[model samples]
Target: MSAPVSTGVIPELFRGLFDDAAVFPPGNLPVAEAVPAHRVHRTAWYAEAVGPLLCGAGRLGELAAVPPTSGAVGGAQEAGATPLRVGLVLPGGSAELAPALAAAAPFELAGVELATRDAAEAVAELDRLLPPHVPAAVELPRELLRGDGLDAVLDVLVDSPYRAKFRTGGLVAEAFPDEDELAAFLTGCALRGLPYKCTAGLHNAVRHTDPETGFEHHGFLNVLLAARETDRAAAAAVLAERDGEVLAKAARSLTDRQVTVIRNSFTAFGTCSIAEPLGDLAALGLLSSPDPLPQEDR
Candidate 1:
């Protein structure tokens, strides 16, 4: 199902910005439970702020086993309700995309994200197999980020229909790209006019170091602001900014056209916990609090 359009209080900069990643990483929510929780999110007052539920290609069988009635909420019947929208992640690369697409026929296939060492080969496969209407994001191998390989991939993507995907954080500290590297990526895509999405580790709206793991995390809001800067150094500066009020002030001051331009390139980021980012935005005054759910729904 297409995401419900945003209205009322949520700002234009944030609509459909947080793609649900509860099924992956630390959350690791089972597909059965995630389905019902996603239903609750879709039916909530803040539904517009949410995006498709992401599921790995290897886990489609687990998702397929979820009972039909598992998604029903608020007295709604499953028979006539919209199928859950899902973004398929192909970590095994394009080889797994075909069968994964077939398995995902049961849901609304929002998009595809595939990681590959060969950008050229992946683009060729995507061209041959991907439905024209379904968007795909090619994840360039991290090894390529610091070398000529990055440009080679960008060159291919510049001429293809697919966008780019970047990994911003992971389980270990080494997985998180430093401000300079991330700045280069933002600037690189901007130079080519290629839109991109981020996955993993963007747990909040501002940059900070995790006290438990000592990992320096990139903030989704910093990314939003960084995407708007043309200079690599300026972009890096934005990415490294840690003050919440400064980031919030910068975010609040964005003109409508500026927001459009920023979102056009930055797109969306997958977040494991929707409430964390939503709460951050609310605390920043960028988003108003959503109405409380009834006792039963709560």
Candidate 2:
């Protein structure tokens, strides 16, 4: 359902908190199809909660073929009338990055997400590839924590304009990080004052095991609240919370100061379906209206 204009009821901390990832797994919508759907979402009443359409670096040619300023794939606005802001997901140290960025130069480049095994190498590549105006979030293999790579990567990112990212879930069971790993990641980021983003398996607002995949997924609310906390123990407790009511209450309890810190530190997450989270928000009584029209009605 679409949310009404903000009346200061919904926390400002959540505006633009969900980046549309319809082109990704589960959804796997065609780029052309996703583009129009995203344009519609941008104009919806709850549009404030949505961010850029995320596309992979490998699909630069497909993105480039779409008219840069097209209003929507099949809408009233004339083609090339409104430019699309796209987030490019790049493989770790992909040599195609330079060329991909050049290919999509006609549109607004929202940000970049890189997956690398070596944090140090990722940092160096980011320096070489990322434009100052464009922000980047690097995801290092969780296994890197076995050595000093995680520490070294955090050290460099601590002072840089870029941020870090964590994979919250994926297609495989092993893709989900255990509590200890997630706790360490959160603790590390807070300790270093490093802001971060999350991606995958956060379709719902509360942690739950997906019956279809039997993989336990984390809640975006849990992570957001965890980021608000500086104490590692307290944050870990929040991360482990699975009760939606408890999580909702904790979210509502946040003071303006806490909200500011949480939003700044945690930033936005990528979700394949915007509707799922928005629906959850409505169910939790967090939206402007509990029974707003469904997205299709808009």
Candidate 3:
């Protein structure tokens, strides 16, 4: 793999942790990487926070009702660009909102990711009533994104043959699938053709086992470079190997090629540690520049 330029990586890379999140450090990122994907999603409060920059109609029921003219997304479609995906964040137990949310139906925003089992069912049921008007996808809970996840949730709506048909998108939550468990998930995905974005605990650039905590940090940077054609069991070997020498070399160099491999995954870099975001961005050469405008301008 070759290193990618900051300009090339930023467009798709620029998405806030959640639309409602107000934690972005006032800094310049490539305009593209700083924005979310075609079908954007965010916590319910995202609109309350950065609603202006977001071109949605407003929160419709539980979903953000975005008119094509107002969103950052519609321009591409008009230009004959490949259709972009748009979706809403379905809260953990927003079942009651399903009917109303679906009312915005045949509407954009790739299906919804449910926060809980109950919410998953609601999205599934809504998909049923959607009448096939639009494409629908259901985000699997972190559990179903893991090894054996397909079977575990085979009976659940996340695996439903009907409305909740497991959409391809997945997320890795380090808590459930510790590094060891994560390896299984990655390997499984490789075998079954699954790729995902990880959230919350993966801000680091390497796969390291905290000496004190004895747990591994779930950064996909290492995985992107390390996963192989024989990845079905690669996770166990790579993670268990815990070769500080190899990962250390990669991080120290932070070469463009290495960063590009990781960025290619479109997987998120996250952590409870604030440095995680800056570190990943810095690794990608997404340098931080002071905001020219007053803090209020943001």
Identify the candidate with maximal lDDT: 1
Q: What is the lDDT of candidate 1?
A: 0.84
> What is the C-alpha lDDT profile of model 1 across 1-298, one tens digit per residue?
3346455767889888889898898788877778777776766777888888899988877776766654342222266656778899999988998899888887778899999988889999999998899998999768787767777778899899988999999999999999999998898888888999999999699999999999999999999999988789999999999999999999989999999999999888888788888888888888886585312211
Model 3, stretches more than 4 Å misplaced?
1-6, 9-87, 91-111, 115-149, 152-176, 208-216, 226-232, 239-275, 284-298
User: What Cα-based lDDT does every candidate model obtain?
Assistant: 0.84, 0.76, 0.38
Rate residue 13 of model 2 by lDDT.
66
Which run of 10 residues does model 3 get worst, by summed lDDT?
43-52
Q: Per-residue lDDT tens digits of candidate 2, residues 1-298?
A: 1222554434576788899888898778787667777777776667778878888877766765654233343212244454577888886355656877887676677898888776666677778877889988988767775346667778877877788988888888988986666777787788888999889888789888888878988888888888866676787788788899998888888899888888888888999998888888778877665336345311
Model 1, poorest ten-residue lDDT window? 69-78
How far is each candidate from the true structure, as Cα RMSD in Å?
Answer: 3.1, 3.7, 10.0
Off by over 4 Å in 1: 1-5, 70-79, 293-298
Prediction 3 TM-score vs. true: 0.46
TM-score of 1: 0.93
Candidate 1 clashes between residue pairs 3 or more apart in a chain or in different chains: none
* Model 2: residue 200 alpha-carbon error in angstroms: 0.5
Candidate 2 Cα errors over 4 Å, as ranges: 1-10, 67-80, 92-94, 146-148, 290-298
Q: Candidate 3, residues 138-256: lDDT per residue as tens digits?
A: 44565555545554443343244322222211132234355455555554444433334444434455556556656556444455444432354555565444454565454446566
